[model samples]
Target: MTRTFRGRVSRLTAAALLGTTLLLPSSAGAAAPFPYQDPALPVATRVADLMSRMTLDEKLGQMTQAERGSVTAADLTAYRLGSVLSGGGSAPNPNTATGWADMYDGFQRAALATPLGIPMIYGVDAVHGHNNVVGATIFPHNIGLGATRDPVLVEQIGRAVAEEVSGTGVDWDFAPCLCVARNDRWGRTYESFGETPDIASSLTTIVTGLQGPALGGPASVLATAKHYLGDGGTTGGDDQGDTQLSEAELRAIHLPPFQAAIQRGVGSVMVSYSSWNGVKLHGHQYLVTGLLKGELGFSGFVVSDWNGIDQIDGQSGFTAAEVSAAVNAGVDMVMVPTAWKNFLTLLRAEVGNGHIPLSRIDDANRRILTKKFELGLFERPLTDRAWTPTVGGAAHRALARQAVAKSQVLLKNAGGVLPLARDNNKIFVAGKNADDIGHQSGGWTVSWQGGSGNLTPGTTILQGIRAAAGPTTTVTYNQRGTGIDGTYRAAIAVVGETPYAEGQGDRTGSMSLDRDDLRTIATLRKAGVPVIVVLVSGRPLDIAAELPGWNALLAAWLPGTEGGGVADVLFGVVPPTGKTPMTWGTSVTQQPINTGDGKTPLFPQGFGLTY
Candidate 1:
């Protein structure tokens, strides 16, 4: 049974978890506990008392979130910053589970040393299973999970992710990307569950999984609904580009998922870097304040995207005007990343000159502090090593494998070529993705734009096939599909796009399989064996012209860290049930295709063939 992580641990446990505080203030423990530090007080009462004790500088610091690389423990003590975050691929030296916990403890100690002793919060883009960690269980991306159409399974993945994240002392996750991906050409198509609001909204179960029915549980990590408002419906699938939809279209297409997230008690909402109709979301008061906070009744803090405030003025860098606009628009915490100091200085001036109001600052602080108290961060500010071993545990990996298998969409199994015979058969597996773990995991793995060639620990698809094959069965693999003379019973060509994320992943040009993949499959075809083309991709590729030549096709959308799941379906151990999360394009010209758009797709949304 799952443990309820929101139960606040004792102060002794928190101190033990924190270990020796090298930077504990010289006057530590001399004063009595403040009203805000009392565990029995109401959250509102505590937040109010904490606000009373804080100075103007401390109040400003509570709203600033700095990137880990740009700030240190000493800086936290001096600036009294409220939060810190590890950008994608950012980690401390040693970059292991213990290293992360130690780094977090160091920072917590500094924050505790301050006059008010307001514990700071740490955040990460743990979108796909604590991805920054080298050996964490990397679950299938949102598109793959979306294919499963199982909200229960998504919630389970969320719980596992929260456990892994908590083990590393990260309390916040910028995940459950509820963007209703309307265009396959968008680089972030995989981040969305499906091309419709229903799919994304259903997966809000992940919020419950992360938060564990309520906040401040044994392994709870606050979940975030990201890139708020129309990031997925961008013009030309352009990342951080203009979204030309009207208010009605926007409310219908993109707003439902956020509503679901809020209902699930999601602790944070990330402002999108993209614009709606022309106005950037980071500075949109009517939407952020009036719609999200006022109408939606969202009490959680609104965080800015990575340097998202900087783009509000359509400029190269953030300015005083941008700071004022974002705050005035109801942004509680500014994620300025490297330029946090500048943000603090400018924001302080903005408040002094009446450009930004005091009520807004207090409201933002109240929202931010309430969640911190609700999360029991004030009581347990350090890593509980008990959860550390769960980071890449066997159980989590098994769950990831299950998710991968469920996510596999059997697009084509013509002539009954699937469910390859397990015994007395010879299989030839070829393609760049078949043997590469990094290629299958795709972007947002250990790095920002995920790379190929043994990036982390995980079984490759070819490895899974070999492991799943019967003792009598023989499996052979070649990267380029060479040396085949019809001796094999079947040729499995795992081919698709290489690893990419966000900006680089957009398909403004042709969305066809790369030259290497085409050549590899073509080579396999010449051998006269039944060809099985498994697509390891972030989004549906334009494979209409090539579909006729292949005997079988499986849309394996970037199954992360586990390849055995692919073999589970291939060898008849698991039935294929996944459907297309996004409309599969026949050609690159159908860039913004969706359900009811009237454009003929190669495989319409929800199209999947089972044996």
Candidate 2:
């Protein structure tokens, strides 16, 4: 009889067991009445249960995301803030992976200590590897990856980046910028995959790589498909300017990538700061709700860009009206960085007044909590320190090297100057970018608008050249190309734009080679060595006049950290496979040149050379 009874009890369903267990005292000697605490329940059921128990304050808190510097751990608990983030360049005092983990754990601790014990999510702009943490592997920016035209490679890079991020306890990444960059003059052009929606749409494989097969798996992160609806087609190639394209053009040029990302089950969609047809995206109900959520079937929460709501009324600061509009428009999460307190106050007041409906509040909380539950935040909220060592690991760096090699576009290999013989040749390397790791990595490195000179650990182009050279080869370096002589078989002048991001990088004037770069090439030319120009830039430069003088030209579009990849193609270790992701304009005047566009470019889209 005892054996038969035990057998029957063992066969009970998990829900039945959990139901039976809830009747008894929990380990903490308290009643576990909430069904949300049970891991076996469906995410939607758990979200509903949790939302039912939450107060107005708690619901609003889940929708607020404050920057790390703006709020303390104690404040996180006091306000029941749902999320925290680190802006570019923002880091802990130690600025190590461990430090970041500790920081994240502290905030999470505060969040869990709240009445209901909901864990808070932390986000960062880990666009290129775990960029905020020093010593983290910095992969080449999106422009470089776009040039590769290899979705599989880009996806692998995303997985590696997710691993590093998970090691540091950051669960959310504002990455894989899906904008179809229409104009090279846009300062944020490098953030785009290519000029066409196809390139960006193809690269949506990164969404799978980031989140993995499922959300709760190890190395899984919440991938964001960002800058929704026509940020890339702005007039005058402006950063936050209006995109005056017709609805058809917007859907054709910018919507496909987002559709692909949605199909891949992207966890979040961030609204763009830019406007569409003289309307701010942050307050655009049609795009955010009617289009992205309704038509696209995107169940994931929509998040506002950093302080994006402030610009809805062309204002300097956000107001109650802005909050109402943004929330009503379906921005489930607000990145109120520094103004979170004010935002919360306004949001609460607005909700109380029925300006922002309680249904919308519940909807936002439901969406946010669903992700938190799916992330296994309740079961495992702290950092997965086991992944810590993967940061800057040899395997990841090797992968980065491969990506860099694949991204190298040989624009002009005149007289087969490239595939340079590794042995018995004197090589002279010169220019600002040749030996500078920071410059090679480009913006969104350790800091916001990444700085130059050994800011982080990585092989410089000169270092790679020397390492790849044979025993008999001698490689000499001079930043200004002053030491080159006629005896050298070839001179490599690696010069281009220094690090800048967003509006600061905008080029309204001439996009010609700088005076310093021209001078460096002139110095090398005077020595009678065949000048090989390795342009380390984010976008195509106007080099039509200077192209005639250089023997070979390589567009090394911001190859981060692993400069050996650049050297790989240079010395024929790897073949040049990268095609021009953007149209190489004949002059700066042909600003919006694209593949099907009427303007004839210096190097058409898909142009590249091999050994």
By TM-score, who's the top model here?
1
Q: Candidate 1 — worst ten consecutive residues by lDDT sum?
A: 21-30
**Can you give the TM-score per candidate against the true fold?**
0.96, 0.95
Q: Over the stretch 509-604, how does candidate 2's per-residue lDDT look in tens digits?
A: 888889999999999999998999999999999999999999999999988899999999999999999999999999998998899989999999
lDDT of 2: 0.89
Per-model lDDT: 0.89, 0.89
Which ten-residue region of model 2 has the weakest summed lDDT? Answer: 2-11
Which tens-of-lDDT digit does each residue in 241-307 have in candidate 1?
9999989999999999999999999999999999999999999999999999999999999999999
lDDT over C-alpha atoms for residue 204 of model 2? 92
C-alpha lDDT (0 to 100) for residue 230 of candidate 1: 92
Deviation of model 1 at 94, angstroms: 0.8
Clashes of each: 7, 0
